[model samples]
Target: MNHQKSSVEQQYVLFKLDNEFYGIDILQVETIEKVMDITRVPHALPYVQGVINLRGEVVPVINLRKRFNLPEVALDEESRIMIISIEDMIVGLLVDSSSEVIQLEDADVDEAPELGEQKDNEYIKGIGKNEDRIIILLDLKKILGITDTNEL
Candidate 1:
């Protein structure tokens, strides 16, 4: 009899941004909150939606659509704020909607395709295959410009 342990699977929080699907590692996500009032900040980056008071902690929020340079659409009922922690910084990412959580083995992920001269693609970690759709896995740290100590 052969007893082999299965490979560990990674979990991801799936969200929608425009018409596309994106996935973020579940470990990085702190919580998901409904769209709330965001206080606008002066002279902030275009992607910075503003700050939100999350249980007393003021968290900076970023609109994924604007960060990705996608066309802007009015916020709807499905809008959500995904609070995630990268390194020691906690930030909120405004997404169209968070649908489900999925698990995938390392083998199911493929390297992101090369889009020459497109700097936006730099934040993509990989493309994950699941059922009939593909999920673009994002490197939250890179997207937020957090450098790992090991990388230094």
Candidate 2:
């Protein structure tokens, strides 16, 4: 199998959070599911909503809004859970909604800007520009603080 991409445009799974658009590498995404019951975990991080029984496999779920310190809103009809794989881990992200996959060219993506703390912005992979839209591409490992420091 050829691992090389057929096109220069990279594809991403787009989701909405707090009305802003965010994208994750499509290759890392397993599936997108509707909002389901989550079992709360004791002493888990504030952003972790809980785990869900996904096909007998318990997958931890995180609230993206909470993870980003955005205002919380009650999950409604449009709510969804994005199941993604990062390295050896599989986790779900509770998003406001997700319904599309987008393609972005290298020239259309800009490096994540240096926010207040450059080190704190590693989770943002880049900013994808498509016409009037701007999608925030994310690095799941950095967002979940799962980067292996041992490799450093």
Candidate 3:
């Protein structure tokens, strides 16, 4: 095990959603792209915005706001699509805006609090404290709805 406590610094790709800052493991991020034309996929989950031709691959995109049940808003110039691959499943996450990448040591992270019995809150991995900022660290596995490990 190469894991160390506070000695290890983990990088997170931060983004804004409904004015709140959120982050995901930097390793899972493939690229950050500007908003592009998306083709809607019928019978898909509500959160799913549909697919895009990323290079030659058709990657599915999801709106973070919809996924979190936040009020929807129009995309602006600062809007971005973060391409992330978790457990061999590659997808694009649409965000209000793209933020800079940040590093946080383990000591800077606190476990996420229990937010009632809502299963949606389970996607939060921890709370990262950076200076005066609070970044909600997200668990991509749960966000991607990957409940079956053996099936993968």
TM-score of 2: 0.91
What RMSD value applies to candidate 1? 2.0
What tens-digit string does per-residue lDDT give for candidate 3 at 98-118?
789999998999999887886
Q: In model 2, which regions exceed 4 Å deviation?
A: 1-7, 149-152
Query: What C-alpha lDDT values do all the predictions have?
Result: 0.93, 0.92, 0.93
True-vs-predicted CA distance for residue 25, candidate 2, Å = 0.3
Q: List the residue pairs that clash in candidate 3.
A: none
Model 3's alpha-carbon lDDT is 0.93
Candidate 2, residues 16-111, lDDT tens digits: the string is: 998889999999999999988999999999999999999999999999999988999999999999999988789999999996998998888999
Each model's backbone clash number: 0, 0, 0
Per-residue lDDT of 1-152 in model 1, one digit per residue for the tens?
67486666999999999878999999999999999999999999999999999999999999999999989999999999999998789999999999999998888899999888768588999999999989999999778977777886
Each model's RMSD to truth, in Å? 2.0, 4.1, 3.3
Looking at model 2, report the run of 10 residues with the lowest lDDT sum. Answer: 1-10
lDDT of 2 at 124: 94
Model 1 regions lying over 4 Å from their true place: 1-6, 149-152
